[model samples]
Target: METNSMEAIVLEAPGPPEALQLRELPIPVPAPGQVLIRVKAFGLNRSELHTRLGLAEGVTFPRVPGIEATGVVAAAPAGEFAPGQQVMAMMGGMGRTFDGGYAQYTCVPAGQVIPFRSDLDWAVLGAVPETLQTAYGSLTEALDVRPGQTLLIRGGTSSVGMTAAVLAKRLGITVLATTRNEAKAAALKGIGVDHVLIDDGAVAERVREIFPDGVDNALELVGVPTLPDTLRAVRKHGVVCFSGMLSNEWIVKDFYPIGYLPRGVRLAAYGGDANDLPQAVLQEFLDAVAAGEAVVPLDRTYRLDQIAQAHADMEANRAAGKLVVLP
Candidate 1:
């Protein structure tokens, strides 16, 4: 029998992982143009960690903090989707401006929903929505990476970084990723990284040692602290797309583009949402994973009560891949 309330992890205020309190809340009713999802699973993200620690801007108190969710439609008043249709929802102010996927049921704008068909485990499906969207958008929309190109990914062990490597390799692109922990180099290699550079804060010289002129493109996930060096790792006319902020330092103070950026190299950035991720692209990636042609790079799974441990693990960088929670 369906209940009128569901268990949810609510962030009452910024603090430690313990701040995420599990409680019973009323199931949200779908308004016009909104779809109510029975959230099967959700992925843990640094954005949520930041929100929990009072670092993320525009976050209100007593909010649920999941940026992405995968589930079946419980109700869709707009008739855009069937009642039992499988779908994923992400980032249309989810988790920040409003309650998100940390609950068993979440109501979101229908436009943010991407419908798909998959018998894959919810833990696996949970890891895809946001990670794939960011990686796909960064590669195609921001970098425009093509086959036969060499690409460098800063912060290689991150979920987005590892996922990007898999997608790039599938496109026949040579991937050179960086990881601070040498022990994790094999993890990168497992995902088909052509070369793994130990991130000593300056891998541009080593990148040049391999391809004298530097790489063809680079994805800066480490944020501003390493962006300058990342910029140096790319070739002239090559692009650097500033994407992830794994370092939690995004801004470059007193910016001067002339001196800050390389002369011929172009600088781009990617922070896309559901609109940027086409339904076809998402479906194709899911199908590839299901067929064993791709991987989800999932590190661990947790229940709603284990959210605190999950956040602690993520904060300590204990996981080598994406952390997901089955609500």
Candidate 2:
């Protein structure tokens, strides 16, 4: 391969995991206000999965797909970071609008590439971007989890769910994490969560048995199908942050009808937007992980060539935590 070119996973036409073709493409040259990233590692997010399956609209063909990444600055117009300085970025129309992080090199808007300072490895840091951002937003922005409060993680095994559980526990919050997989319950408890509940359809019933008043906050990672149970698990006036749609159902019909909502319960939602995450906040979160104050568990690592297998494991429910791809 030419020195100016780099390896990348390109989506010629959205289809199955096999459509993510590994090819040698010319490395991107940063335009003014943008920096060329020597992507060391990138994460596989559900948004990319949806795009690769042709589920996302407005996606032109022959595009590289990846929403979040962690790496060093290869080239940049004189700015806040020197070449080789580490950085990370998520959303910001990364994979959806143009070429993103599924490559050895990516050109990102300078404003979007957050200077992430941490001594963690690329694979470890790569696990932090999207998962940490979403988890932090849901905990601090939406749920406002406080010390001594009780929290519920509906999709306990999902990346967001697990991250939220760990952050809440660190804040002295009692977390009641739920998972449909009974075998995973012990793993949840080992993560410092106060309790782990089997996520059967009777989640509300089980929760009520443990805490009669219900949990103080709930992070509903699942979608419409589990929202009702999640609502019932929260105490009156408590908050429920409706985040990911693990069930693949985006909207709930008649969700606004008062009867379906828990009395005095508040609803909040989390969506990925580059601007929504301030640089200082992102830095602080990464600092905590670097200091061992919070945990962002990484499940699997794949080479750029094994991109298809990574997506396959994610879709098969085999990954117990975040999946990172080393480019």
Candidate 3:
């Protein structure tokens, strides 16, 4: 690959994972207030998979598909970022609007980039920015999780769910996580979760056994299908944060009004708007990673050429943690 031309995974059409193909394209230049990164690794999210399959609209074709990435700064606006500095960035309209981290290099706005601590590995750092921020935002800002409270995290073993579980534990909040896999129950316990429910229809019953009435907060990662169930598991005056919908159901049947509103519940959705969350929360998430209170698990790594396989693995739910694409 020439310096001015780099290899990237491009989706010329929407369909299966095989739609992704590696091709050489002209390297993009960073604009003012932007930095060019020599991407070391990028993490895959369900949003990327949706975008690749045309499930997520508004994304132009021939797009490079990756949202969260960690890399070395190749170039930056003067006084903004120094060359060779390690950094991470995440958000939409990134891999969505312009080319993203599926390539050898990507140019992101300097404002969106965060410097990583020297001790962090590139793969771990790459995995941190998106899921951690989402979890932190939902827990602290949306749900106002506090010490002595109890939180129920649906999709407990997932990257965001696990991040929420660890952060909540650190804050003195008891964590009860839900998983479809019984094998993951032990892993949840190892990560400081107090309880792990194996997706039984009796989630409310199990929650009552642990928290008596219900949990103080809930993080709904599975979306609509679990929304009603989450409502049933939260205590009066509790809060619920909705962020993901991996269940593939777009239309939520009927709202469980009595279960949510009559109980003085707060239902919140985040990640659509960046400014909806404070930058301080994002910094706190990064600091937690720096201090070793939180860790981003790198389940597998694939080369840029293996993007199709990576997507396939993610869609199959075979990845236990973050999946990284090394360029």
Candidate 4:
């Protein structure tokens, strides 16, 4: 545990889970307008998995591959934040153009950091940053969801889907969540879903069976494979926010908006960073989580040394919720 050097899971080149190797690297020093974060914990994302498999574009190796982190501010060269202030950082070229949260330290632009205070454990806190920002942004910015609206989460068991369910319920929206696994249905129910639809590729008819006029909105987390059916599951003027890509099939070849979208069923996509998560919203969510009014869908936690196994479990779809690593 030297002050200058820290442990990190470095991706030497795109390959398997074993490619994420633990190594000692110099703690990054922040320049003006940048903040140095003493990474406590970081969350595993499919984005990182895609990078490891060389599916992601613009990735450079030997790199650290974590997109989101939660920790305390070790230094803010621009004085944007006080030392020891708790914060979360994500995106802004993290784990992509430069070293990211896969290390014990990561330096990111100040604009990419959102400040918050909570007594929640680092593991729980780590899971909230990117996941919550994406979920909350998709709900508010992409879908414009409101109270009394009915939401259909196409990938309910995924972390973002589950988090969206919680946020939707808290907003007084009626929730209908879908899961491919019958065993995971109860997990969705535990989060206050009004109905749990078993997804067998097409859940539109089944959605109509419940809502009749179709749901007021839908959150498509399974990517383009389910986008069409999800579009059909929404009512006229209802929106579908394309968010997560649990299936890792994001691109839709020969996409024709006219034929692709159901008339009046508008489709929107959300790919947000930390800046999209307003400070107030982040603080409120953290407060809710700390008060037990909300929950972080954290499935399991691992140490820095277990990054390979963690990535393997993530790739294998073994976790029902977010997988986090403590560095």
Question: Quick one: best TM-score, which candidate?
Answer: 1
- By lDDT, the candidates rank as 1, 4, 2, 3
In lDDT terms, how accurate is model 1? 0.93
Q: Report the C-alpha lDDT of model 1 over 210-277, residue by residue, as the tens digit.
A: 99998999999989999999999899999999999988888999999999988888899999899988
lDDT of 3: 0.79
Alpha carbon lDDT of residue 64, candidate 1?
85
Q: How accurate is candidate 4 locally (lDDT)?
A: 0.92
List model 2 lDDT by residue over 1-327, tens digit each. Answer: 449889999999988889899999988888778888899889888888889878886788889999877899988885757899998867777887889999998988877778867787889888878887888888888888889999989888888888888878778888888888887777677678788888777798899899999989999887889888888988989998998877777688866658888779888888866666677877877788788786777888999999999998887777667889999
Better of 2 and 3 by lDDT: 2
Residue 11 of model 4, lDDT score: 93
- Winning candidate number (lDDT): 1
Of the two candidates 1 and 4, the one with more favorable lDDT, higher being better, is 1
Per-residue lDDT of 1-327 in model 3, one digit per residue for the tens?
436898888888788998888999888888888889888888888888889778886788778877767888999976598899887766747778877788888888877777755566677766766777788778867888889999999888777888788788889998999988787677788788898899875577789877788888999888887787787788888888887776755556665666445367678776643444355665666677778776665678888888889899888777656788888
lDDT of 2: 0.84
Q: After superposition, how far is residue 129 of candidate 2 from its true place, in Å?
A: 0.6
Model 4, residue 191: C-alpha shift (Å): 1.1
Instruction: Assess each prediction's global lDDT (C-alpha) against the native.
Output: 0.93, 0.84, 0.79, 0.92
Candidate 4 residue lDDT tens string, 1-327:
447998888999999998889998888888999999999999999999999999999998889998889999999988999999999999989999989999999999998999998899999999998889889999999999989999999989888988999999999999999888899888888888899999999899999998899999999999989999999999999999999898999999999999999999999999998889999998998899888898889999999999999999989887877999998
How do all models score by TM-score? 0.98, 0.95, 0.91, 0.98
The C-alpha RMSD in Å for every predicted model, in order, reads 0.9, 1.7, 2.4, 1.1
Model 3: how far residue 43 lies from native, Å: 0.8
TM-score of 4: 0.98
